[model samples]
Target: MIDQVRALFAKNTFLPCDVSTIADDADLYDAGLSSFGSVQLMLAIEETFDIELPETLLTRRTFASLENIAEALSGLVSKAA
Candidate 1:
């Protein structure tokens, strides 16, 4: 799941640094994730995982880091199952 998230983040988010080099808990916003980029990433993630993230989960905190994104997707994916 993390791998998928990382791939989506790397492809969707226009980060200054390599997503692979960053730690799971690293701040993506600090790495150059703008609001527009966040929305793009969110849409890409939803399509890739076939899960629509609730509006409530669409926040800076939810997309803060790789771990956070994974955590959010984990819950949503489980519920989807």
Candidate 2:
């Protein structure tokens, strides 16, 4: 999951540092994740996971870091399951 997120950032050329080194709790925004970058990440996540992120899930807190994004995806996957 983290790899997917990192790949997305890498593909967009928005990541500022080693994405693999980013902690799950790291603040992506603080780590140079711009609004546009976030949206791009969101799209990539949706496509990779094959799930639609509802509007309610689109928030700074949810996409704050790779861990948060994974948690959100896990929740959505579980609910679907």
- Write one digit per residue (lDDT tens) for candidate 2, span 4-79: 6667766675667767777878898898888987888888878877889999999989888888887788888777
- Provide the overall lDDT of each model, using Cα atoms, as 2-decimal numbers: 0.86, 0.80
* Tens-digit per-residue lDDT, 1-81, candidate 1: 788788886675467678999899999999888898888888888888898899899899999999999999999998999
Off by over 4 Å in 2: 1-12
* Decoy 2 TM-score against native: 0.81
Error of 1 at 57 (Å): 0.2
- Per-model C-alpha RMSD: 1.2, 2.0
Q: Give TM per candidate.
A: 0.90, 0.81
